[model samples]
Target: MKILLDFVPLVLFFIAYKLYGIYAGTAVLMGATVVQMAIIYFMDKKLSAMHKATLALILIFGALTLILKDDRFIKWKPTVLYAAMAVALAVALWGFGKNFLKMMLGNQITLPENVWVRLNTIWVVYCLFMAAINGYVAAYYSTDAWASFKLWGYVFPLAFIIGQGFYVARHIVDDTDKPAEPPGDVQ
Candidate 1:
């Protein structure tokens, strides 16, 4: 359900684009994003920083595309977003000696500090790669091609996540795997 909610805006944008055009798609995307966020807020009672950032970018870039009558603004949004994420993660991890991935998910999943660092590093690299690829397609390709890529590019993240899941699973600590305390000898 949450995944579907997250994707509603993108699917709507694509359908709108196919039925109308980029401008219409942008408008629909903006509206759908707002609706999506509203629903998420209602359900979760809070929004993640990522959600807020994504909403802001969609609205800002969508408005720019509509107002200027140029599709470039909308097309470049993903590149800007991915690049921003990569820079944020890299600077936080290397410059400030912070692991943001661990900060966000530490409570939910336990892993060794080294694993957290490696995960954060992987995220930074992945974001940069995604940013570069999107920028390349957006810059060098036609709008139609770019739109198609936007839809098909879902594969990259899906694969990345599945691979990450398998990697993380190997490192996940299972309480059941630990030796039980003998009788009442709790330590």
Candidate 2:
């Protein structure tokens, strides 16, 4: 549900571009971004956390693209946002002594610290790849193709992540040295 909210603007942008034009879609995404941020601020705990900063950037640059009436600007937004997120994740992992990935997803599965770092690196590299892919599509592909990719390209990665979660969960060591499982429920 929350993931869909994060994706709403991109979806809208794509649809608008298909029906109207780049500028029109940009306008729609801009409005959606404002709404997204408002939800992030007001509904942090109840709904979803605020990791849509990259999406917000997309919206802003989309607006700039509309106002400037240049497709290049809008095309650049995703690349910049993706690269920026990659850097931010790397910094959080190593330099800032933070573990954002863990915060976002650790509790559900457990793994070694090294695995976490490697996964973190994978995430950064993945973002970079995403940026490049977006650029390629925007520059060479038709708007319809770009929008289709935008809508569907997310599935493989999401499925990969979910599978990795299961793999990691299977390997977790119950090293707390207590009962094999938490209290309550059937034996």
Candidate 3:
């Protein structure tokens, strides 16, 4: 359900683009994003920082696209967003000596600190690569090509997630498989 909600705005945008054009698609995207945020707030009672950042970017770029009558603003949104994420992750990891990804998922998954660092590094690299690719495609390609890439580009994240799952799985401990220690052994 959460995954579907996350995708609602993108799906609507795609459909609107196919049926009408970029302007109509942009409008639909803005409206759908608002609806998505509202639903998330109602259900979760709070929004994550990532959600707020996404909402802000969507509104800002969507507004620029509509008001200025230039599709370039919208085209550049994804690149900006991906670049921002990469920078944030890099700063958090290297500058602050903190692994934000591990902080977020540490409770659910246990791994050595080195493994966590590796995972964070992988994400930083992935985000940077995604930003570069999006920028290149948006700048060099036609609008139709960019839109097609937008839809097909989902494969990258999907593949990354599957690979992440496999990587994390190798390090996860199955508590159920271990014999219980005596009460006095608790520490």
Top model number, TM-score = 1
Q: Per-residue CA lDDT of candidate 2, range 1-187, in tens?
A: 6667768887887888889987888788788877876787687643333356655676678767878788777767777877887888989988997877777777866667777777788788888888888889888987667668877877855775786667667656566754676668876
Better of 1 and 3 by lDDT: 1
The lDDT values for all models are 0.93, 0.75, 0.89
Extract clashing residue pairs from model 3: none
lDDT of 2 at 100: 76
What is the per-residue lDDT of model 3 for residues 132-176, given as tens digits with 9 covering 90 to 100?
999999999998888878877878987898899999889887768
lDDT of 1 by residue, 68-166 (tens): 999999999999999999999999999999988999899989888899999999999999999999999999999989988988888898789889999
117 Cα displacement, candidate 2 (Å): 1.3
Off by over 4 Å in 2: 45-52, 92-98, 103-110, 171-187
Best-fitting candidate, scored by lDDT: 1
Is 2 or 3 the stronger prediction by lDDT?
3
Steric clashes per prediction: 0, 0, 0
TM-score of every candidate relative to the true structure = 0.93, 0.74, 0.90
Number of clashing residue pairs, candidate 1: 0
Q: Model 1: how far is 99 from its true place, Å? A: 0.9
